[model samples]
Target: MIRVERVGPLATIQDLGRPGWFDSGVGIAGAADRSSLRLANRLVGNPEGAAGIEALLGGLELLAQRHLTVAVTGAPAPASVDGRPVGAASVLEIEEGQRLRLGLATTGLRSYVAVRGGIDVAPVLGSRSRDTLSGIGPEPLRAGDVLPVGPPPRTHPIVDVAPVAAPAGDLLTVRVVPGPRADWFADAGALYRGEWTVSSDTDRIGARLDRRSGPTLDRRGAGELPTEGMALGSIQVPPSGQPVVFLADHPITGGYPVVAVVVDADVDLVAQARPGQPMRFRPC
Candidate 1:
């Protein structure tokens, strides 16, 4: 069992996310950096879909009430177990009554911490993820919230840490393909290839891209379109012409025209990007 002695800015349980529940108004609120979460889970012998804590901007702390193994991954936050420094992505023996604290992240925006047997949060709509926009499942973890730890299976698995680095340069290379509504805009490929700056108005919902010229589209003959289902990597262009890349916690539906969609492999890179960072799209 783990006790939350101190919860930082934002921390919540997340797994692979409950896909196909969007029709029921449930958003997939899984880890923004899915690779890191998977790495942590593998290190601790947890299932790939096991729910773990997703710490935004780091600063997550907890006290272990039982002897268990834990692993941290994602952001480059200096971590410590019982006041001693520990490396991220490596398994550490967390003994009972030991305190663990994570400092601020320097490179990425979010981090993942996986524990043996995973966090035992009651799943909502088949997911342990916290959806702030839809108010589904548990709320953001706060101080005094006792996180339940479940018993693990008899067998244990070993996984070596695969070092992942932060994306270099202010300009991010995001791979994208023609979207469903690509024909809605002129020069879809060219528009995406152009450089766009990440605006301060970015979050789990979406990252707003600042473009110099508005997207040119012909909607004169088209009727008022109904709101359509949105995907994780969708890039929508509203009347403002600026593109907004949907993230893990984005709404299920939107009415804006999707210019291009980022490739699944590169979405995590966008999710980890800080504000004011410049990004350029490339055709897949």
Candidate 2:
């Protein structure tokens, strides 16, 4: 078990997310950077889809109630156990009553922490993911919360350390596939040409882009688009003319036309993009 000492700005338990529940109006609410969560789980010998803690902008501190192993991944951050520095992507053992502290991210926006047995939070809808948009699943972590850890796997930890590239850069290039409503726009090619800036309004639901100089994308169809199911990477353009790239906690349905959808593989890049970062879209 572990006790949450500080929850920072936003921290929640997440797994692979509750899929196949869209018909019931549930969005797939999983880790923003799923690859980091999976890698952290793997390092701690937990199942790939095991529930772990997603720490936004770091600043998470925990106290271990018993001996266990833990791993931290995503957004290289300063981590320490009892004041001793530890590597971010390496496995570390925690003794009873010891405290683990994660500092602000040096490069990325979110960091993942995985315990050996995974966070044993009660699941809702077959997943432990917290849907920030719909207020489903567990609430965000708070100070003094006691989080139980499940039994560790019988098999030993596979790797001692596995470092990944830091998800930070000045410019982020995302590949997109033409969306079903591409014809609604006057010039679909303009999306690829304009250099958009990640807006401060970005959140788990979507990343809003600010195109300062280009002409607002003119809609060919004047009528309102019928409400339809939305996907993880759906780029929905609202009346403001700015594009919003849907993320893990996006709504299940949207009324705006989806101009394009980011490729599945590049969604992680979008997740790591910080506010004010320059971004460009490319057709795949």
Candidate 3:
């Protein structure tokens, strides 16, 4: 078991997410960076889908109540145990009463911390993920939270450190395929023009990309379109012409037109893009 000493900008217990509920209006809300969460779990010998803590912009502190193996991945946030510095993406032995702390993220937005055993929170809808859009799963972690750790898996840790490229600090380019409503835009190619800045309003539900410079995407046909089902990576363009890349917690339906859809793998990259980061969309 471990206790939350302090939580920074945001911290939530997450697994892969509760999928297959779209028809029921539930989005697959889980770790913003699925790859990072999985990597952290793998380092600690836990299943890739094991529930762990997702720290937004770092600043999460935990006190281990027992001996445990742990790993920190994503965002490469500065990690320390009992005032001593530690390395990210590496396994560490935490003794009872040891304090594990993560400082502010220097590059990416979300950081993942995985314990030997997964977080044993009661599941909601067969998942331990917290959907920020819908009040589902465990609530955001707070100080004084006593997190129960599940029994460790039969498998044991084999790797010591997993080296992964840190999240990008410069402009990020993502691949996109044409969206269903691409025809609605006067020039769907507008997505490929000019750099898009991640808006401050961006959240787990969607990433609103403010058009730094480019004509607002005007629809060919006037009048509003019917509310259509929206999916992860669905790049919906509002009347303002800015493209909003839907993330894990995106809504099930939207009325705006979707000009282009980001590729599946790149959706993870978009999730890590911090506010005000420059981004470019490449038509695949």
Q: Could you tell me the lDDT of residue 67 within candidate 1?
A: 93
RMSD of each: 2.4, 1.2, 1.0
Taking all chains together, each candidate's TM-score versus the true structure is 0.91, 0.97, 0.97
lDDT (0 to 1) per candidate = 0.81, 0.89, 0.91
Question: How many clashes in each candidate?
Answer: 0, 0, 0
* Maximum-TM-score candidate: 3
The C-alpha stretches of model 1 lying farther than 4 A from their native spots are: 167-169, 212-224
- Per-residue accuracy of model 2 over 126-202 as CA lDDT, tens digit each: 99999999999999999999999999998778788996788857778899998789888998777888699999998
Residue-by-residue lDDT tens digits, candidate 1, 1-284 = 88888766788888888887766787787887788888888888888888899888789889998897899888778899989999878888889999889998887778889998999989888889887677787888888888887778555766555566754436678888877887776567656545777898887778998864344433333544479988888998887667899998898898988877888998888988877877888877
lDDT of 3: 0.91
Q: Look at candidate 3 and tell me the lDDT of residue 59.
A: 97
Taking all chains together, the TM-score of candidate 3 against the true structure is: 0.97
Lowest summed lDDT window (length 10), candidate 1: 212-221
Candidate 2, superposed: residue stretches over 4 Å from native = 212-215
